[model samples]
Each structure stands twice: as structure tokens, then as C-alpha cells.
Target: MGMEYQLFYWPSIQGRGEFVRLALEEAGVAYLDVARTKGGMENMLAALKADAHPSLAPPFLKAGDETIGQTANILLFLGARHGLAPRRAQGRLWAHQLQLTIADLVSEVHDTHHPVGIALYYEDQKKEAKRRAEEFIASRVPKFFGYFERMLTRPEHRGVYLLGARLSYVDLSMFQMIEGLRYAFPNAMARLEPGYPGLHKLHAHVAARANIARYLASPRRIPFNEEGIFRHYPELDEPAA
Candidate 1:
């Protein structure tokens, strides 16, 4: 493609932007990870404030003169544009829905640490995080993963992915989620994995892809840390049920 796409996200952590980056990388598309570069986050913020329509958050994309925000929206836009989305209308809608669900899970992951408010530090809300993390580990994680597992096992789509016979943007997203959750809650994931063989296989499959393997090996894939979503607070994570 002649037009280079620009992705705006936090400079340091992978956060939500990694979803978009993975899709772009898998496609081998040439694009600018704006915030990762020098002066990139500043430029992104300036553009956001300068625009008539201020974005609700970071991880927006600037294609030509237009800018769009929301993690799932960015993926949908890129998925369609780059042919990473499913071709059939029904499949496309299902794929987008899957992506939205993944986004919801991601937000919940962030909320485990920032339940009271994003402004508050994890230490400030460590008690609250403990409570939220229990609910997340005991209820929410299984619910979300169960839904995905069932979807993957559907007769119409009986394969490793949400959509059978192809790896869509949602698959990349699921892989990211699996990676983050493993980092943040290693104990929980270890116990949980055996039950979700479909998800486990999907995670392994995505990691094995040539582009993803290359990306994971490269320094560009930021390490998970306490600063971002999916933090590893020992008190918040429980041994698998």
C-alpha cells in the first residue's frame, strides 16, 4: 500500500495498541508505531486535542488526515482495510463481535488493578484489587474463556480459531489476552489451561506464526510489567480451582 498507516498509543507499554500492532505486523504492512518513536506520544496528544473530535483515549490510528480511536474500532478498520477480516458479512460481524468481547476482557483486566479509578495507583487500591481480582479469577475469567471455548467448538467453526479455517484479527487478540493473563496470573492460568484446550491451542498456534514468532523475538514486543494492565500482584491471583 502506498499510504502508510500511523498508530498512536502509549510510548512505553504495549497495552491495547499491541492488538493493532500485531495485525499490522502479521500482514507485513509498513506502518508507523507513532507513540513508540521520539516525540510520538506528544504528537498524538496534540492531534487529539487539536481535532474537532477528541478521542476518548489513546490507541487511535491516523490514516491520511483522518484519525480513529477505540481498540476494537481500530482493529475493525484495519482488518477490513488490510483483508485481515473475514470476507463474508456474517463472518465479519461475528469477528467484530469477538474483538469487542476481547476488548471488554482487556478493560476488565485493567480494572482489576484500577477498580476505584485509573488515577489511583495499584498500591492505593491494592485492597480493592484483591476483591476485584477474586471475582475476576473465580468468575469472570472462566466466563470469558468459556464463551470463547464454546465458540471455537461450534460445529460451523470447529477449529482452533473463533472463525474456522482462518486466523482473523480476533485470533491475534486472543493470543495477546492469553499472554497477558499468563504473565499477570501465572498460577491461575496454569490451572485453567488444561480445561481450555481450544484456547491453549489457539494461543500456541498464533505464537508459532512466522510474523508473530519474529515479533515476539524482536525487542519491539514490550515485556509485561506492573505499570500496564495484567499486573502481577501475588495477593490478587489465586491458585487455580
Candidate 2:
């Protein structure tokens, strides 16, 4: 149970796979980031076509024989096993809910750079991307951030973590959300961040966690770039008036 996971993800970008990586790192469990190794892309392709449970993409987690697909589903599994989530049904469900919402936010973030389709380059759809990104910065960003801020500032929560008393996978995902958004939309974040102090606080808290801080400092952490879901484009991230 100590070193029992093989995470198959693209060698390059942090992408969605990073959420699982952060969770595993924080749990202090050893996991092979399979695709990061030599000949690992082939291994990842093999994993995608496995007979019993084939996933059409990367970011699948291999937990023993079981291949957990999708970011939220993997976290749902990991949270239960690693005490990153609560034991009780209501609390566990709440953590899962937050993770799912974060997933949605990630999708919206991706669309900022690929509004028309994933197959096209950002330049190919640059016009659509600008429109999408502008709306995202003006509307969707606030919508998602506001919801999370309210969750953090809720009465029982007292603005510490998403699930109130303890740190959960949801909080880890929140850290990624802030990091990715800030990377992709720096000007927007600078303008909007002061309003969501709780989220920024949560991001800092997660960053300062012993394992996560180490991971961020290490070579294992993939640098953000145009290839990833969170791409930095000043054209796309038009500054607010």
C-alpha cells in the first residue's frame, strides 16, 4: 500500500494528471509517473487500450489491477484510501462535489486556448479563443471563484479548507486551480484575486505543505507552457479595463 500506483500521463505538461500527482505526493506514497520515463509513451498507449477498462486518453491511474480513469474519479478513489477525504458519506460526497466543480473549471480553462476544438492550434482558432478567453476572464472565472470563495467562507468552514476541519483532495485541487488560472490569466487574477482572499490563502497553505513544496521544487514538477491546458497568452488574457 506504500508504493502501489502507476500514474500514466503525458511526459510534458502538468495537465489534469497533476491533481493526482499532488494527492499522491501529499499522501507520501510512491507512484511511477509512467509516461515520464523512457519508452513510457508506448506504455501509456498500451494502458489506454487495456481490455477490461479502456480509456481514450491519458491521466489514468493504475491502482493495482484497477485503472481509475478521469481526474475526479481517481481522486474519489485516492481520497478514501489516503484519508484525503472524510469517512462519513456526506463529507466524502462534499469533497467529491468540489473536485467535480474544479474539473469543470479546468475544462473551461482549456477552452480559453482551444475554443473551437482541441485539434486546432491556438493560432488556428485565435479569434474564437480571444472571445472565449475574454468571456472566461470576465464571467466564468468569477463565477467559479465566487462559488469556491463562498464555500470557503461558509459558517462551519471558517475559511480554512473546503471540507471545513481537515485538508482534503478538494483543497489540493483548489491549489492547482489557482496556480493554473494565475499562470494562464495573470492580469485577470491580479485584478480579481484580492476579492477571493480565502482561496489565495488556501493556495498558499497547500503550497507550504511539506510534500507539495518539495514536489514543486523538484524536477518532477512540469513547468507550465503553451502546450498544457493552462497556457499563457497575453492576447488571450486581455487585461480588464
Candidate 3:
């Protein structure tokens, strides 16, 4: 029988939840996508408010009596349980390091539109978003992508994935990042793609994974839109190359 893992996240936006979802799907693990289910968001909220421990922002996991929060932490827990994480001490730490880096990039992506404050709306903060988006497109995106590209191209682990041979949760998160960035900044990504062949290849390879392909085709995966973290505003994108 498959393990029972319950995921709690916001229903509307993919955001950080996509990272956990991707890992679950790729691992072929049967799990409950709680918030996406009927009345799931309400249940998630109740669970959060009731907990004595410090609750996470979103995308948490529950296994039996235990509840854990944060995207990277959830992924780490699942990775070790499902044998997706490396057994070696160094490899395990590296996987976590990669995951944390992805988390940082995800936050930067969110901040591009809501840099001033999360309490404010995009329409209310359009001016700040434009300025933040400029910095994001010009510097942040390239810096993060360049780092991952270099990691993948490292001589010690020079194959397809960050860990050379294995397909870890980090690989899935990178694919999601690439997808989100392409949607959020199409023009910038088009020009930037040429410089990060490793990332491009990684994106392509992950897309071809059977489970990922199925998840992409299925209604379970929400399409990118204005409401999500990675939103596509033509103004935010750079000029087409």
C-alpha cells in the first residue's frame, strides 16, 4: 500500500505548493492534495489555527499525528521517506542546500510583484512592482539561474541533474522555477535561455518525465495566471529578443 501523506496549501495559487506537488507526483506517491479538494482550504486553515506550534505560511504536510510546515522542510521529509533523497551525508546536505536556494528564489519571485508588502494588492502597488520587476528581471533571475546552471555543470556532478545521476526533489523544483519564470517573464527568459543551456536541458528533461507529463496534462496542475506568484504582465517582461 502507498503511504498516506496529506498536504495543506492555498487552493487558488500554485506558489510554493507546486514544489511539494511536483515531488509527490514524480515519486509516484499516492497522497492527498488537501486544499485542492472540496472544502480543503477551510480544513487547512482550521488545522493551522488550532496548532500550538508555529504554523507555516503555506504548503505543509501531515503524516499520521505529525504536521510539518514550509516547502523545503516538507520536501526534505518526503524525500527521506520516499528514498528520493541521497543517503550519503554530503549528498543529503547538498540536496537540502539546493532546495533552500530554490526557496529563496521563489520568495524573490513573489516579492517582484509584492515588494512593498503582502497586505497590498498588485493593482494598488503597480508602481513598486514595476520597479521591483525590473531589478528581478535584470539581475536576480540571471544570478539564481546562473548559480544552478553552474552547479549542474560542475565537474563532480556533470550529467543532467544537480546530483549528477539521481532525480531529486531539487530537480523537480528547478523545473518548476524554470516554468514559472518563463511564464512570468517570457521575453526575459527567451533571451536568458541561451546562456543557461544546463537549465534549459534540465527543464526539457523534467517535462519529459512520464509522471510530470501526466501531471501537466491533468487538471490537478493549475495553469499559471495573474493570481499566482509567477504572474505574466507584458510590462514586466523584457523586449522580445
Candidate with top TM-score is 2
Sort order, TM-score high to low: 2, 3, 1
Residues forming the 10-long window of minimal summed lDDT in candidate 3: 51-60
Clashes of 2: 0
Give the per-residue lDDT of model 2 (tens digit) for 68-140.
Answer: 8888999999999999999999989988988999999999999988989888778899999999998998999
Runs with alpha carbons beyond 4 Å of true place in candidate 1: 1-3, 239-241
* Candidate 2 vs candidate 3, lDDT winner: 2
Per-residue lDDT of candidate 1, residues 65-164 (tens digit)? 8788888988888888887888778878989999999999999999999999888778898899889998998899999999999988877776687788
How do all models score by TM-score? 0.95, 0.96, 0.95
lDDT of each: 0.87, 0.90, 0.87
Per-residue alpha-carbon lDDT of candidate 3 for residues 1-241, written as tens digits (9 for 90 to 100): 2558888888877888899999899988888888888888888889888865547577788888888898899888888888778988788899999999988999899998888999998888888899999999889988998899899888776569878777889999999999999999988988889999998998899999999999999988989988888999888777887
Cα distance off (Å), candidate 2, residue 122: 0.9
